[model samples]
Target: LLVLGVPPAFALGTNKFAASCASFTSSLTFIKYRVYDGDLLKYLVFGTLLGAILGVKTVLLLDSSQLRIIIIILMMFVAIYTLFVKNIGNENKFEGVNKKTIAIGFIVSIVLGFYDGFFGPGTGSFYIFLFLTLLNYDFKISAGNGKILNFVSNITSLIMFALHGKILYSIAIPMALAMILGARLGTKLAIKNGARLIRPILISVTLLYAVKMIFDITNH
Candidate 1:
């Protein structure tokens, strides 16, 4: 949006709003189909709420240049690690949710949820990665649980942006509707391709975003 002359703040807020709306809707489907673990989602909400509050303040405090640089550095690391680490999300070895697992989930939920409110470019990707590494969930289940956590963090962040009067309803509402429609197709394809689809998409998007961040830095 900035490339096309949309105000940067408005773009960020609108995108966050639309994505939150879409994520909320898609999360319901995941719950309906039993793709997500209800037990884990409980702690995710708590961690995400606290993290989102901190994140909203962080983004509001930092200048765009500083924020972009931080985001680029973090995303670059994620992209590299994901590419080099092979066969990480291949299997589901979920040893039933325990206090240990929930503890780690809380830490990461705060971190990733902070990321969501601060920028939100790779919220889902990070959630999926964290769940896979932390809980030993396969691509399918990780993606499902990721949606649930992402939705909560997104809503939390959206409320913050809304409170600040940043949301652009004209842009957000339409994008949200389109995103909801696309969610149907996205879920269907996930079912059809399974890990084959999720793994590559995650890696590819992470890398592409990293590259884009580099470009953004250089251009700016």
Candidate 2:
């Protein structure tokens, strides 16, 4: 949608939010109880809600250029870690996450949500990585669940933006359709290839978005 010249609010309002929900629902229906965990899903949903509310406030005051630099640095760190950080989640051994970690996850989700609402870049990939590295969720599950929670945050932000009259409905509808199609394809690819493929894509997208932000900042 951004590549297509649709505005940010419209992009989220129409495309990403709807696509996320559709993909999540479809995945659940297709996979059934094999992978869906209700407790983990609740945490994700809560994170999304918290993030959306924070997003509303953050968009008004955050500096885009500063954010760009920060995200670039963060992505660089993640990329480097991915290269050398063997046993990133080995400490936990796939055990259920602790309460402290869950709390931290909630906080991180809110912070990221605010960033997403304000900047609208690499939000999905960020969530996936956070879950993978911090919470020890496998990359595939993280990506799948990330979509579910991200949809929640996107929808909340969209509603807030729409209520404030920021969304351009004309662009939103078509862009949304495009997003839905894109997300479907993306999700299928993620499912087929599993975590190894998803990790590289996440890094690539984050780096690209980081570079775009840097370019925008420099141009401004």
Candidate 3:
């Protein structure tokens, strides 16, 4: 949308709207598959919602250029690290809910939720990475849980945008329809293929976003 000349605020609102639709659909699919960590969702969603509210409130007040650069660097590091760690996300090592795991979930979700509400790029990917790293989930389950949390954050941000009258309903509605279908198909594929499919895609997405950020910064 930005490349197409839409204003940043409008693009952010529209993106949140469409993403809310997609992530909601994906979350339902993941639930149907029983792939998500139900025990931890409460912690994740609560922190995410709280952080999203704070982030939305502060979005316009912050200078995010430095943050974007840090995010790009982090994304690049994640991509490279994942590329070298062949078995990292291929096996699930989660040992059920524990105090330490719960704390990590809440903290990471809050931070990424803030990032999602503030700038909104690569939040899902970051969630997936944290799930894999901290929760010991395989790629497929990580993606499932990540999408669920991302849905919560997206809806929270969408509500804020809607309240502020930033959303373009005409564009967002049609885009949401397409997003729902695309999310359904993509999620089905991920479920079917598991880590073999998801790992490379995660790495690719992280690298692509990093490069896109670099491009945006250089262009600006």
Clashing pairs in 2: none
* Candidate 3 colliding pairs: none
The number of clashing residue pairs in model 3 is 0
What is the TM-score of each predicted model, taking all chains together? 0.91, 0.80, 0.95
Ordered by lDDT, highest first, the candidates read: 3, 1, 2
- Score residue 185 of candidate 3 by CA lDDT: 96
Superposition TM-score, candidate 2 onto the true structure = 0.80
Candidate 1: the clashing residue pairs are none
Candidate 1 residue 83 Cα shift, in angstroms, is: 3.9
Q: How displaced is residue 45 in candidate 2, in Å? A: 2.3
Residue ranges of candidate 3 with Cα displaced over 4 Å: none
lDDT of 3 by residue, 1-220 (tens): 7778877767888889999999999999999999898888877789999888777777756655568888998999888888898889888999788899999999998998888888888898899899998889999899999999999999999999889887888899999999999999999999999988888888999999999999988997
Worst 10 residues of 1 by lDDT: 63-72
Residues 47-81, candidate 1, lDDT per residue (tens digit)? 88888778877887775546666766666676676
Native-to-model Cα distance after best TM-score fit, residue 62 in candidate 3, in Å: 2.9
Give a tens-digit lDDT track for model 2, residues 74-154.
Answer: 877776675577545222234565687668677777777777677666777777778777778776667766666666777
At residue 74, candidate 2 shows an lDDT of: 83
